[model samples]
Target chain A: MDYTKQIQEIATRLFAEDKIDVFVGYRLTGFDDNQVPALIRESKDVPLLVFNQKSVFNLSNYLKNDHTRNKRVGLVVKGCDSRSLNLLLTESQVKREKLYVVGIACEGVVDDAGQKMQNCLECMVPAAVVYDELLGEANMERRFIINADIQDMAAKELVQRREYFEEVFENCIRCNACRHSCPLCYCAKCCIDQETATLYNGANTTSSAFHALMTWSLHLAGRCVDCRNCEKACPSHLPLHLFHKWNERVIYENFQEHLAGVHEGDRGAFYKYSMQDPDDFIM
Target chain B: METVTNQLVSIEKPEIVAPPDWQPVIIGILCNWCSYAGSDLTGTSRLQYPPNIRIIRVPCSSRVDTWFLIKSLQTTADGVLVSGCHPGDCHYISGNYFARRRFLVTKKLLNFVGFHENRIQFSWVSAAEGPKFAKVVSKVTEDIKKLGPLHLYKKENFEK
Candidate 1:
């Protein structure tokens, strides 16, 4: 769904009516057709809002940033991005009343190479679960399917699997772009940061990568919405989805087939329990 | 005690044979309110379990970070076990309930990444279940022994 025209009109109306103090959307990156997130504070910038295939960044990451905090804001979100926003509301990180949400019924966003991103291909919900005004037609037939890569990883031997992740970890520079780009990693002072972490010296070692990424993924176990922001931000091109999809797949299997951020006020898998929860793994 | 003697005599060897004297270094992260108290009860009651497990008591099993489990496996530990209060019985009221979900995901992830699920174990041993605690420890110890040493995540020569 090409929503460039509709987004421009909505932003203009929201600004003209003074319904929002700031309107967050995407603008042309100036050099390419690809879009970059733009925070427009004035009515004049309303025309810059655009939503197209290249609008891939989950704009919800900006909700916790300094620019949008405590402001009456307007923002656009795709299916996965809306889920993150839903989680932010449930986690008390963002107030739903202070913002206007323009939700999009996404038709699988494509990469720069024009192929459907892996997360989009596996997406089960293509419509926003929470939105003040939803755009586009919802595709109701998609079902939650495990990613092909995860299925392949499951078939490998134990040593082979360890060797694969070893390579993935070795290439990591510990730059933490993945953590910074993640919407759920909104901690004021992240524990994985070397200065604050008491458990392990935050170094660029492979061991540190294992520690940091494992902690990061575990924290996002029941919360990640597969926005793919972390994967897109990684400089090493490491398949960070392996960690998240692993957690997502496991939680789906063991915790009442739970999916993250699909509803308002959902407390996630770890925060709540059911007596029917699988205990065969426990002794 | 009698339970410990029986476990020592009934130990099973894995398909891959190693030296008879090599014992797995198992790290047990036990919750203070239940599993740790249960272990204490085992000692006081003279119930015997394997001595290979080194216990670390945490406020709750949920406090056992996934990093700690992974780091233990990568470092000195040959196997890891996390024991907590039974579901709905956490001292902190829902700490173990949450831990059950966390442990399930952690175990599945480890197994997906080539670590055998047997290398790590999760159990609930209530404060009064001294015999049950002994049985769990012995069972986990024997399982680890049968799988031999866990060299999968060890730091030495892992760079390759």
Candidate 2:
């Protein structure tokens, strides 16, 4: 992880050469052990780039946002973050030529509590799958594991399972933090917004909460990079991964062990064609 | 525990059941080219279906965004049925295809968050199939009734 000097040097070079209009990275917050996503537009701001366990938020989320969209940008991405960036490229959300990606051979980033995230712990690609520059020492590739929560959910009876998820949906406040925090949720006028949806009366009821959460999750099914940003952003602390992990498991099992954004050109599971895909589920 | 005590009280003083007078409200979003016309045909042929369903016609099934579905659940509706043209037969060519992809993901997410999957339905009904449209509506109504009212988020509102 001791790539601080290297990161600073790269930032300086990008600014000096004017190769990028902005450099999006992480900087340590003044009052806490956590790091916040930083946007550096000038050469003087290059010193703000730092790498440590506290640098948690995926920088890729900012790329699809208004601030960075259509701009020549330099971005730092960890193992998990890189996959998301790769997906953005594959989906044509951003142009590859416009980006100067500084790839990190991540040795796992820790959460605010200094604990490793589940996805980081089981991360198979500890380096950027698609980047213009590489950083840190490459680690051995690991195996992807089905998250434990999803495994436990699979064992529940139909009624019991329904009850378990019902409790989770009950806590949603309809703030759409999960959707906003998500990099994939870039729709200009999201359907769930109050003014746009005539059907949803825009009230914060349990039924509405259930519908909103479900719709958001499904929207990200194959595209989600397991960044867990949505889960972290959710004020209710809902186990959003249960939905994602379940979809991931099914996609993996049915679609030739497909992983979203693992390769630069890899299309999503639904977007691709295969003679071997499971036909039993389709009517 | 407080939970145990509450359960015991509920068991000791059982709530009496009322007669089955509850009629579920179903919100159906029909694609203008196919499902909407199918419902129109049901009216023309005088084929009787449950009056519980209220239809909204959209230009294409893809226009039925996730927000509309959420809004339906929050309103008076007990179930949502999004009916479109068969795959590859959409009036906009690939509108139904996009809807199919979206619906699959939405269904999985809903199931994950604990909403009963039976409460929402996505189907393909051609403009010529009036009987099929009626049958689908009736079937969806029955399915939602078996699950009862969506009280997962509504119980707290009632408690206040």
Candidate 3:
């Protein structure tokens, strides 16, 4: 997309105006067709800002980190990233006034294989819902599609479902790469860290791996934006989205089609209460 | 005389036997205001339960961070049990409410990454339910034993 030129132009202007202390975006990693997250502090660094099919990382993860905290930041957000930003604002994780968001009317970003991500393919919002300046021609909202894995999981017998998940847990290495890559996983010391988690040693055993991965996923349930960054960053190529999608599906069907971070001030599903929420599942 | 000496030497030698195979370890974090007292009552009544569980007492269920659960799973425990007061009965008025929300979200994530939901247990136990505490521990112990040593993520030390 010619949006790369627009992004660079904006970065230059932000630097010239001295309005932003740092601009977080993406650049080529120089090893392959993959794009890595780039933080531009100088105006001269604007040339490095390139948006292409390989720019896969969700840069909003940096917004919650200490490095960017309290600093006036100019960030580049695709449709999905912008939604996460919205959630951050609602959660009080980040202040809106401190941010100068460059929103993109995204023409869906590509995966490592250069194919459109399933979330993007089923994208309901192709334009940044909350940005200071918007780019690209906004596409119409599409219908939300239930993830294929969740459907297949629902079809399986209980015993078969257990076996299927057993195989998935068997592949985890317990590196915490998924946590590290996630913007919401900003705990100073993670629960999976060995010294702090004395009861659950960080031994990387299969059980340990299983526990670590699952716990990390649970922490992100309602808050996860289905950005697919964790799944993409994972070395074992685990289907991380199924966890988020299943929760998303449940929230969508049960709640008021609640999408995390769609609006600037919307609270999360669990945070808001309704007298009609189903309690049949609870004894 | 030589035969006598050989007999003595053979008699002095100790037999070498293998240690028992590693048993699945499960750590249960029971809130003091509810589940811990329940566990203590189970002990006072001499209720028979599996010895697999090692319980840690916490003031409230909310104090048990997700990191504590993760770390327990990472280290020695095969499964984790987080038992607290039933909703609305929480000693802090709303500690268990926050816990319930946290557990629901955590359970979803653990299942997503392929951990069998069976490995993590969340329940509500009041101080008066001593038998129930024993039952919960016994059930978790039996379930973990059948699952065998948690091997989905290999212990780094076990590697050559």
Model 2 chain A TM-score equals 0.93
Candidate 2 C-alpha lDDT tens digits along B27-129: 9999999999999999999999999898999999989887577667655677789999977688887776666655655555455444566767888889999
TM-score of each: 0.90, 0.78, 0.73
- True-vs-predicted CA distance for residue A250, candidate 1, Å: 1.4
Question: Candidate 3, A159: how far from true, in Å?
Answer: 5.7
lDDT of 3 at B40: 92
With a 3 Å backbone cut-off (N, CA, C), the pairs that clash in candidate 2 are A165-B114, A199-B71, A200-B71, A206-B153, A218-B105
Candidate 3 chain B: worst-modelled 10 consecutive residues by lDDT: B1-10
lDDT of 1 by residue, A18-73 (tens): 89988889999989898889999998877787888889999999999888999999
Question: For model 3, what is the error of residue A75's alpha carbon versus the real structure, in angstroms, after optimal superposition?
Answer: 1.8
Candidate 1 C-alpha error for residue B138, in Å: 2.3
- Of candidate 2 chain B, the 10-residue stretch with the lowest lDDT total is B1-10
Interface RMSD, Å, model 2: 9.7
On lDDT, the stronger of 2 and 3 is: 2
Task: For candidate 1, give the lDDT of residue A104.
Answer: 93
Across A72-111, the per-residue lDDT of candidate 3 in tens digits comes to 9999898888888888787778888999998887777787
Question: Which segments of model 1 are wrong by more than 4 Å?
Answer: A194-200, B1-21, B152-160
